[model samples]
Target: MILYIEQEILLDTQCQDLYLCNNGLNNEYLLISSSNQCSCKKVQAIFCKYDHDSCKNRCLLEEHLLIKRKKQTNSILINDSPANVVLLNKNELEKNSEIVFICHENNLPSPILEHLKNLINDRSNATPNPSLHQTLIGNFLLKHSVLAQSAYGMYLKLQQTRDNKFQLRRHANIGYLLANILLGFLCSFILYRNFDLYQLISNEILIQTENLTTSIKSIIEWLMHAPAGLKLNQPLVDFLARFYFYHIYLWSGYLEVLVVTVVPYFYKILFILCLLGISLAIGAICDFIRLLTIHLYCFYIYAARLFNWQIRLLIILFRLFCGKKQNPLRNNRLDSHLCDIDQLFIVTLSFTIFLFLLPSIFMYYAVFTSIWTITILTVKLIQSMNQFLLQIPIYEFYLWSTGSGIIRGTPRLSINYADSTEDTVCYNFNFDPVSFITLYRVCNIRLSLFSLSFSKLFLGILKGKSIV
Candidate 1:
């Protein structure tokens, strides 16, 4: 195998030649080789050595003398040179190295300096040039550090700006949410009280009854004034009379009863009122809770967010329980405005303090009026039921009991004949006060229909046709 050996020549004084072997330590030889011939007298006093390891014994000169001779020859060539300019940057200053040529024609030209400029430019164009800028070389690696610091500063500023924007948005959302909750609370409170119940019941009874009566009266008077004299059934006349009397009496009696009984028993009445009162309060609270939830369904003009329909339904139901119609206003605006719970409480309190608060001396009489109205209605219902039983006669088996009677399902599964024999049965339904009101309302409707139908039939017979 053959080995490739490389060697380099440098102008250091201690060594003439330095050789590098791929697998061996460096070797120095004390032989001085030059391209030009050397004169013997020029560096003869300097000691010389020609110590190539192959010729170490043959040469007698010292290594330092040969190095000095070689350097002097190179110096002669450099000092005798006619280069006009030299590269003075780091490597060039140290080793007098060449750089790329720039022609004198490319700069200012003078004939006296032309030859020197050409020689300098030629030498500059040679290979193995030196760098002229030392500071740039020393500082090149620090560029990335400055850039990284600038980037980090910008990032911190952006982060702070984003955080501030987020805080502002959160604050605005909280304010809007709070405002909505307060508004819902106010609206729901108004819906709780039934301000229009009494007005509605009274107006409905008066208007409808008057219309019905006037229609009946017109028919009766027309028949009475007919050219031919007429006759009608006696029992039909009696039924008509009884029906008219009962409903009219009951209509008038309701006011007296509510005024006398409910005013005195204000605590019990207040309880009934508060049932809807606080329920609406709860609905308002539910709306507030729902506002915070992601679902926005409860917040709107026609919905729970604006006015909860559930509370309105409850108020209507409670009024029906108190024997009143769902609609109590002739004027639509009054119905909407006056039906609110805040209005109801105001009216109820005002009436309680001002109208119903007469002296105790007249208090018993007021209560007596309520009891008398109840007695009249009860008697009319019993009389109607008796008339019904006489006609239908199938429910004679229904046994009588107190207010605690079982009512919903089949209640008479096991009844002994001995316990069942009684001329009149008394069944009490007192659990819900509304049950009594509903019972009476049913009786009133039946009595009114029976009376109107019988009256029309009687008048038809009297006129011999077309009474309705």
Candidate 2:
């Protein structure tokens, strides 16, 4: 268990030994050599006081020298040829001096010892430690055994921590998906049962088909006047008019569906909306995970492309004559033109008021049609709270979705609108998350074909305005 080392080995004087000094004083041992520092220095001069024990004394001296020599052989000089540090075995250490230099190296606590035991035999209950020596075979086995034990304990603790975090993340994703599915089913059921609810409420004043057609015509007329209206300094009117007409047209179609269809037909529409909402919710979750999985992917694709908090804000301000750039340069005119296009989109989307302006109508439709959207949207927003004990206000979550200045994209995922520099402001609202998301992004490709055709028709008008 211990190693001995010596400074040097050399014969000295003042060594005294005696043997058969039987009866009448046979012989006397005498000490020789050395000055006052006799205790510190090696002694010399052995006396063969007795003949019988003379050989024994010589043997003892030789054995002592042999052990010391072994230690000296193992001792390495710092600047020696090999220059590598070598560990000493029992023989090498025993040859060293009685005083040995001890350095203790420590290991971290872990659970890997349990892993090792399980690997060897499934039925074995013994947990091994990293510091524990499984194959004890030498004089230093006791020391190594303790080290192995400590290592195994450390491994177990680390494994448990990793497992817990993974479980928590999985549960959160599952909760999100479950809520969406329930909402989708509920919405479809409601729509299937109450087809004529909207018609009954509006007292036929808003005949679904006729009203929707009239709204679309009015919106097209308003769109024709948008650019000129922007130039005439009637930009706000131009914006609101276009916004209102478009949303009314869209929602009116939902209302019209009830009178024109049977239970199955209305159910089909509800089913579609529910499906779209669920898809949006799923995409939102996927986007969140992808955002965390890769750093650059989060910034470029999700944050910049989908959310677009900065781009949308700049466009809004430029349309309102309050853009960031002062004294716009001729060279940067293209940038200003792009802002104008964004402003138009913003105006058109705001018309529905993100389902807020038409909440009564939407809720009636949902109550009568797909009631699941409200439930899904509501629960999802509530679940986004950072802490379970302190739930964030549901109204606050709603404001984040339907409120102006809240940029829309996917459900339960909205960001406060920011200027071109991405500076946060509390003034006017900019985008509607629900309408843009459920209407544009989540809908099928066929739905988009209709929208693109509508956009092209509007674009043709804009081109005509430019020529004039």
What is the C-alpha local distance difference test score of each model? Answer: 0.28, 0.30
Q: Which ten residues in a row have the lowest lDDT in candidate 1?
A: 92-101
Per-residue C-alpha lDDT of model 1 across residues 5-62, encoded as one tens digit per residue:
1111222334233211111122211112221121211221122122234333222243
How many pairs of residues in model 1 come into backbone collision? Answer: 11
| CA shift of 201, model 2, Å | 8.7
| TM-score of candidate 1 to 2 decimals | 0.15
- Cα lDDT tens digits for candidate 2, 107-211: 200111121122223222122233333455522432322222222222332333233222222232233333444555676567557665644634453443465
Q: Local error of candidate 2 at 385, Å?
A: 16
Residue runs of model 2 more than 4 Å from their true location after superposition: 1-165, 185-264, 268-468
TM-scores, all candidates, are 0.15, 0.20
**What total of clashing residue pairs does each candidate reach?**
11, 39
Worst 10 residues of 2 by lDDT: 96-105
